[model samples]
Target chain A: MIELFNVSVQENKRLILNQVSLRINKGEFVYLIGKTGAGKTTLLRLIYLDLYPSQGNIIVENYSSATIKRRQIPYLRRKVGVVFQDFKLLPDRNVYENVAFALRVIGASRREIKSRVLSVLTQVGLNHKRYHLPHTLSGGEKQRVAIARALVNEPFILLADEPTGNLDPEASRDILELLEDINRSGTAVCMATHNYELIKLIPHRTILLDNGEIRREFSPAEVQQLKVIE
Target chain B: MSVFFLLKEGIVGLKRARLAAVITIVSICLSLSLFGSFTLVGYNLQDVFNRFYKKIRLEVFLDSSLGLDQLEKLKKKIHQNPEVEAVEYISSQAALQEFQKTFGQDLSSVLKSNPLPASFRVVLRPKYTAPERIEDLANRIRRLPGVQEVLYQKEIVRFLHKYLGLGIAILLIFAFLILVVITILIFNTIRLTIHSRMNIIEIMQLVGATNLFIKSPYIIEGMLQGLLGSLLAVGILALFVSFIRDVFYHGIQVPPHLYPFLLILGTLLGLLGSYISVNKYLKY
Candidate 1:
């Protein structure tokens, strides 16, 4: 669903990602494990077309970084949902409005917005607190709301950048389970996190990045061995 | 996106920043009202000047020894000029009679003989009433045979002519300044609103909203501000007009379409200001 051809991103003469190549197949749930400043977020940003590659091209679904028009970025974004560590919900809006906003921007009909927002909220187990404002929600509830917002448009892929960074251990496990459920339901998910411990909890495939370069790929059993080493 | 959704978002934006919206609207209202008042003053002042110009006439005095046939020929010649609207002959006896009537004294009784010269009162066409044009015509008339002198209110005409142009120029400068100030105020207000909602804009972009989708609400907000501000300005101008009529002159003439023109101008200015600001912010 997502492929990068030796992509490189730079900022003010500093290389953020250098000659990085990877492919994420359909319905794959992959964990990007790296330390701070390891180019995990930069990789996800390239996939969403938020920042162009400095040296190479990326193909996400049908959009290409080399030939995509500036105007087409929004349409590309609609097909790929992203969640941030901060949740990025509009503080003044309630849970339902925050999720419905995603559909509204796509000019979804009023009836369709309500229906899809409710359905996604139900999936994320946030339907009961739909009217509660962001400030009133707990950290885990907030991330769930963000997930519902990302899923409201039924995107083909989900990119998460440290989505559970602010959550407690229990909450992080719940979010991980939710992501797994989403991946099993046939939407690819690429989650970038520095938490090696979480990878061992329920691992499918893990790519270890170090200093802007991919070091190794680990399967479920290898992730267990790494957990044993730690 | 639906027009209704865009409009709702606009109203929601205004509601979100009530104080800023009110300040912008008031700024537009006061500036437009001032401009409208100046426009009305210029309009009425032109009317007064036109009425005054219609009454001005050139007095072409003839030599006292000119014969009756020569006087008639001179009158015909002067009347044939394209600039001359009409020419009325006034003999010395008639001139004396008019002087006596105006001064309320018998001028012939005091002079022992009719000393006034016969003259033709020449009324020029409206377009030829400028001070310089009148001077040119007078110079032409002075070269005619049997012509003694051509008299006009030269000093008064020159004063009004020079000052009227300066007055209009000053008025135009002030109107332009007000327009600029209002535009900047609207622009900055919209800019501030966009700055406060920068996060929302980013989120909208991430959620696949087009540039037009993000900008439509701000544009609509600006237009609404303009419409309301202009309506207030028109109301204030109406009150000013009535006040002037009641306290100063009852014959003040206002253009029938002044209010509508001001309303449309205010609305368009708002639109322009908001459009530029949003486009700059979006870089679209």
Candidate 2:
């Protein structure tokens, strides 16, 4: 579970998020919708403690942003998975190595790492492409590798910022569906996207942001209607 | 567990930064070798000084009128003293022979009769090996009957000690400066290597890698370079020492502890450099 208590984020003496408060319960699938500079990235960064709130507190699992030392940030991150828009995989390593890297950092044994990495890659349907490099893969395949890396640790929550931002529509849909399947299997997924078509195709609890404020929250049908108008 | 992964990554990082790593290793090696050579020189200089000091003696030339009985009495009196280690009686005939042996001609062949004086070559105890101490013993011996004059080479010892002390001081200062400069060079080299893969480090942190996990590879790379550089220096120095022994038939003895000390020094230097860089440039 994730909760933000009147969180305000300021960067360079400018307010980025103003008195923002939100909560997502366990095993929930949520969508964060915002334009280019609507503090979407800032909100995601707050969850992972990449950027701490200026005037409020966040609780990810049991850790608090206000009291968390720099040393505890890594432990906090291990409990949550993050997916970037660009599918930030280590370029030099292969798909398997890229996926295993996450597990390796947590002191996983080679045998444990091998089995878990293989299992996660299979879940993402990229077990067959385990040896392929990132540059050699299609947009969809790269996103799958990225997802496999995120899921390898079995995190309490998956935070994806523009997971399909760089992909074609078909690849984007595949990634979204993979995310949907993952959410169904009991891991909370928070996907931040600007794709209106995605909301219509598979509506979920959607939260919209404007000018660093959480403007409104819409149910699946209302968000679907908003997507239809788009 | 993660140790295998860390080691693999460390080796991989070294390969990735091979050019910079090799250059750093060479810098460390060259500086350390110079240090090792100076240490060896200092050790041998001490060795030579100790050997020469042990042989210091006061030479008491006897008067030409003194009888063999008086000379025997003087020799017995000198040998009885606690400070006297040994007293060798060189008769005037034996002194002439020694002179002929040194100059390759009999003194009797050049002059009507040998003018060389018979002397007692008296070696002193270890505590009296100093020039001033020998000078005190020389004055004592000069007052004895049948003794004409007392002589010992005191200036040579003083000159050698004073200059050798200054030389060692200068060497130590030079070594300190080189070590500091080498440490800085290694720190910069390691910083560049880490900067090259900073994104990867950031991603590792993102994926829950601890600070130790992120730092391990860089630290290991630095130590590996250090170890390799130290080995290369030792190999080169060993060959040079062997060459000296073979070509000139004069062995330059290296202190036994120096070889191992070099390895430890090199490794510590590498660790120090990495630590400094990590402190300046790396964070969780």
Candidate 3:
């Protein structure tokens, strides 16, 4: 569960998120849709405690974002998985190591980490590529590896920013389906994307933003209507 | 999470960047070797001079015009001073005989008569051997009746004292400079090794790796570098020391006690260099 109230983010005297209030409950799948410079990444960063909110409060699993100590940031991050747009895998490491990286950071036992990493790799249908290096994997496969890394810790919620922005349609569809399956398994996921087609395909709750303001909260039907019009 | 895993990671990292690690180790050893050599030389010089100072004695030549009674009284006055440890009166004939024994073959044929002066060989306590203290004692002896010039080679003592002080000062400066140079070189080497893995660092950070978790391997690597470098340096120094003792034993006199001290110094330098290098680069 994540909540943001009257949250505003600023960088270099420019407002990125202007007094935004948003909330997502546990086990819910939500889409954060916005154009470039619409404060989508900034919002995700706030929930992830990467950047402090300029004005307002954010609660991620009961920890206050505005007041959390810098040292506690890692602990908070351990509870929430973040899938970056770019698959930030260590080039020198294999897929299994990359996924196991998250578990290692949290002090997971080697045996537990191996089993968990293998299970997540299997879940993402990349079990065969476990030992393959990041450079050897395709964009889809790399993203899958990133997804596996994010989910390896079995975090309560997953925050993805433009998870499918760089993939082809088929790869994008695979990533979306993987996220949908993850969501169905009862982990809350708040994914930011401009991929309206994928949003239509999945038909999740959609939060729309324009110029730093939440323009509308659209039902699955309204989102379908918007897609049809587009 | 386990220290074993952290150490394994550190060792693996070192193995992966073998060239950099070797460079770091070599730099540390070179710096420490220079430092250790300077320290050993300075320490031994101090030791040799201290021994020489402890053995130095003052000679008070008695006036030939004085009577036996006056000589006895003067000797009693000199022996009563707390600074005088032992004083042995030598007659003029006895002094000449001792001189003949020392340079008998070379100068015995050239001399017409015994020219050595009658003197008291005065050995003072160790604490009174300092130039100022010896000078004070010499002045006291010079004022005694029936006593001629009091000789102690004041210039030699002064020169040795000043030279030893300067050596120590220069050794300290050299040690400081070597420490700075070694730290910077090791820091740069470790930084390069870490830079190659910046992506891994970022990913680790993203995955919620604590700062300690990220830094532990580098610290361990630094410690290992220090230990290995020190061991190598001590080994090299030991060889050099043995060679000097074997081939140039008469040229330079190093006291036996300095060997263990040099090894400890080398080990400390290695540990300090590694700690400094690792701490500098391990920070965000």
Candidate 4:
């Protein structure tokens, strides 16, 4: 579970997120919808403690931002997986190494790394692309590899920052579907995106963010109605 | 497991950044060479002083008009001094013989009479070889009855002792400066080399890699560069010593332990350089 208590993040005297309070429970799939510079990525970064909260406290699993030491940030990150929009895979490493890298950093055993990497690769349908470099993989497969890397450690939450930003429409659909599958398997996923159309596929909860604040929350029927009305 | 990966990555990093790695190794080589050459010169100078310190002796020239009993008494008195280790009485005739043996011309033939003075060649105890101590012993011997003058190599010892100390002090300063320059060179080299991999670093951090995990590879990379550079320096120095044997006389007196000392020093410097660069560059 993740909790942000009136969190405010600043970027050089400019307020990015102002008094934003958000909570994500286990197994919940929440969509963070906002326009460019609407503080969507900043919110996700705050959750991962990449950008510290300027004026509030955030609790990710057991680590409280108010009291967590600088050294404990990495351990906090291990429990919350982050998937960047660019897929940020090590260009030199193959798909297998890229995925296993997540587990490797957490000091996972060699046998655990091998087995878990394979299992997660299978889940993301990237088992066949093992040993293939990042440049060789398709956009869809690259996103899948990133997802597998995020999931290999079996984190409690997956903070996806535009997981399908660079993908084509068809590829985006596959990634969204894979995320839904992951959420169903009891892993909390907070996916940030501007694509309203993708919100209709599995609309559990969609939190609309505008000017660093949540404007509204929509249920599955409301998302469907909004899609129909639009 | 982490160590294995770190070492592998360190070797891999060298191959990946060949130019930076080469620059680091070359910089370390030059720095250590400067250090090694200074050490060689310093030790050789000390060797010169040690050679003369062992051979130092006072020539106690006796008065030409002294009676046989007075000469014997002077020799006995000089030998009784605690500083005197051994003394051999050389009469004017024997002195002339030694002079002829050394110069290949008998002093008796050169002059109407054997003019070389009778003296006692007084070898002092090793502890009295110090300039001040030897001066004190010489003064004591000069006061003996029928003794004309007490002579020892004071000027050469003063010159050697003065410059040897100054040379060691200067070398220490040079070593300190060299260490600083080498550390900075290595820090920049490794920092520049690893900067391009910031993306990988951030990704690793996002994936929960600890600071130690991120830093291990860079540390190991520094050590590798140091090891290679020092070995190259020692090999070149040994080669130079082998080609020129007269400086060392018989064999190069560079201690066998110097190799390991350099290796360890290089490794420590590498670690320090990497630690500094990592602390500066890796913000996360």
Candidate 5:
């Protein structure tokens, strides 16, 4: 459902992503493994229509990312969900409002939004914390709240950038499991992370990036072999 | 999206930023009050000119040497002019009696004989009050045999006309400048307020919020500010008008009819200022 063809992204006169071609099919769970400044976030931004490629083309759900008008960007965004590394929750709002915000932007009816937000919050194990503000929640709880917000709209794909970057080991494992369950429910998930240890445990399709290029793709057996040493 | 939702969100935003909203509304009210006062001054000045112009009459002094036939012929000729609305002839005796009544015993002892001349008080049609028309009528009256001097308040009319034009021009300029300044002030306030909410805007943009969905609340808030500001301005102006009337009770002859005009102008100014400010800041 997402395709990139030789896409190059440049910011501040430096190439961030160099001739990167990648594809994730429908319902496929893919993990993008890369080091710092390896263009993982840039690639996700390109697919989400937040930033256009400096060169080459990107196709997300059959819509050309480069040619879409500014007004059409919101519609495209509704079809895809993005989870940021910082959680990006409004501090003044409670957990329920944070998730309901996603549906509100899409002009969902109040009844449907309430039901959907409650169900999604319950799914992410955040139903009891719905009335708590973002600052009052723990790091893991905030991440779960962000995940619930992303999934509340029932998007076709979920692009998460280090969803567990701030969480403890136990909390990180719970988030990863929740993401895996979401993927199994038929929404394609593409998560970018640098933690090879978590990758060893989860065992998904892995695309490894080094120095602005996808240098390796590991199958299940190869991934298992790579994890044997860890 | 339903208008009810838009309104609810707008009210919530206004409530969240109540102080800023009140500041904006008060600023608008102050500016519109000044505008309304200027408009009232302009309206009343026009009324004064209208009243003064309508009372103007032309006086034609008849020559003492003219015979009765010549006087009758002069009157007939003066009536033929389209500018003359009505012409009434006053004989020397009648003029003397009117002068005696005005000056009383002092005037009766000063003059043994009646020196007052028989005159024609000519009232012109309202359309003939222009400078050129009055001049034309005066010139025509001068040509009559029995007419000695044809006098009207031509200089006063010309002066009032010129000053009235200048007054209107100055008022319009002041109004335009006030509108510009109000727009800039309100725009600055809104820009600052929106800056405080920039993170909210960014978050909304990231979550697939359409521009309309995001901007509707701000626009509705603007409208509410405008409505409330104008209402306050009108109320304040009403109080000011009442105070002025009490202070100048019977001293200044301001017409009571101008209150409605002032209220309308104040409301319009408030609405316009809010609209200009909101439109400028809400654009992406």
Candidate 6:
């Protein structure tokens, strides 16, 4: 769960998020919709403690920005999974090693790493392509590998920043379904995307961000009429 | 947390940046070998200066009228001085023989009798062989009983006192500059290596890898490269030392401790360079 109260983020005298207050309960899948520079990425970064709020604090799980020490950021990060549009995978490593990297960095044992990596790869439907490198995989498969890596540690929440940006329509739909499947299994997901059509495909609770502020909140029924205030 | 994992990562890092690692190691090897060679030269140069200092002799000439008893007493008094390491008495007859051997001419052919005076050749302790100290001892000896004159190589001592100090100062400054240059070169090389792998490091950071977890492998790679390069340097220096001993001077000795010293220095340099680079990158 994540809670941000009166949070404002400013960098170089430019406000990215201003006085934004929101709360995400456990096991909820929330879609954060905004145009480019609408502060969607900044909000996610604040939740992960990658960027600090200029005016207020953020609480992600048990770690609070007001009290978290520098040494404790890694522990906070381990609990919050983040995926990017670029699907930042090591180019030289295969899909299996890429997924196992998450466990290896935290000093997981060989047996635990193997089991968890295989399970996650199987969950993401990429187990058959475990030995393939990132460049050889399609966009959807690459994002699946990234998701497997993010989920290897069994994080409490997953933050997806434009996860389907590079994929085609069918592939994007597949990735969205996979994310929904992950959410139903109990990990809270806060996904940021600009494509309003994806929300119509499988409607969920959506939040609209405009000009560094939350413009509106829409229920699953309201998702059909959702429109970006461009 | 596993030491083996860290070691394997370090090896993998080196393999991943094969050309960069090789360039770094070769640069370190060449620079360290040059440094080692310079140190050996400085050591041997000091030895040569020491030999030259030992050759400085203070001669105390005696009056011709002095008898055997007076000469013996004078010899005992001069030898008792703390600065004096040895005193050899050259009789007038021995002086005449020495003069004849040097010029290949008998004293009888040049004069009616031996013109050379009996003297005590005084060898000073190594610590007391400075030009000013030698001159002071000469002045004191000149005031002694039955001592007519005292003589030493004034010009040679003066040259050593002035030029030798200047030479050593220049050498020390040069050595310090070389040390700074080598450190910068190695530091930049390691920085470039880290720069090339910035994406990997960024991925590691994003995946919740602790700073220690990210930095350990790069640091180990640096240390391994340093140790390897310095070992090659030490081997090169050993060969150079042996060649100098055989072809030039047998007295040129490689101190038993220098091998380990160079190895430790090189390793420390690598550690320091890599640690700074990683820490700076991680700060972002």
Please state the interface RMSD for every predicted structure, separated by commas. Answer: 1.2, 1.4, 1.6, 1.4, 1.6, 1.4
TM-score of chain B of each: 0.89, 0.79, 0.77, 0.80, 0.78, 0.90
Evaluation by lDDT, superior candidate among 2 and 4: 2
Q: Model 1: how far is A196 from its true place, Å?
A: 3.1
Better of 1 and 2 by TM-score: 1
The DockQ values of the predictions, listed in order, are 0.72, 0.64, 0.67, 0.66, 0.59, 0.66
Report the alpha-carbon TM-score of model 4 versus the true structure: 0.85
- For residue B8, model 4's alpha carbon misses the true position, in angstroms, by 3.8
| CA lDDT for candidate 3 | 0.81
- Between which residue pairs do clashes occur in model 6? none
lDDT of 4 at B280: 75
lDDT of 1 by residue, B1-284 (tens): 78888899999988987888888789889989988888888787777777777788999999999998998898888888888999999998899989988999987667788888988999878777678888988998999999999999998788877887678778778877887887888788778777878888889988889989999998999899889899999999999899989999998878789999989988998788888888887742
Q: Per-candidate TM-score, first chain only?
A: 0.97, 0.97, 0.97, 0.96, 0.96, 0.98
TM agreement with the true structure for every prediction: 0.91, 0.82, 0.85, 0.85, 0.83, 0.95
lDDT for A25 (candidate 4): 92
Report the C-alpha displacement of residue B72, candidate 3, in angstroms.
Answer: 7.0
DockQ, prediction 3: 0.67
| Better by TM-score, candidate 5 or 4 | 4
Among these predicted structures, which one has the highest lDDT?
A: 6
* C-alpha DockQ for predicted model 1: 0.72
lDDT of 2 by residue, B169-271 (tens): 7777777787787777778877887777777887888899888888888788888888888888887778877887788637478889788988888888887
Q: Write the per-residue lDDT of candidate 3 for residues B1-284, one digit (tens) a residue.
A: 67887888889878887988898778767877776777667766776777777778889998778788887888889999888888888988888778778867534467776666688988877666567878988999999877779988788878877887678788778877876776667667667666777776677777788878877777777778766776777778778888987887644554465546544554454445444544454323
Look at candidate 1 and tell me the lDDT of residue B117.
90
On TM-score, the candidate that comes out on top is: 6
User: Which DockQ value does candidate 5 get?
Assistant: 0.59
> Which pairs clash in model 3?
none
lDDT for each residue of candidate 4 in B104-160, tens digit (9 for 90 to 100): 986666589888899899987755555777788889888877888988778976876
Ranking by DockQ: 1, 3, 6, 4, 2, 5
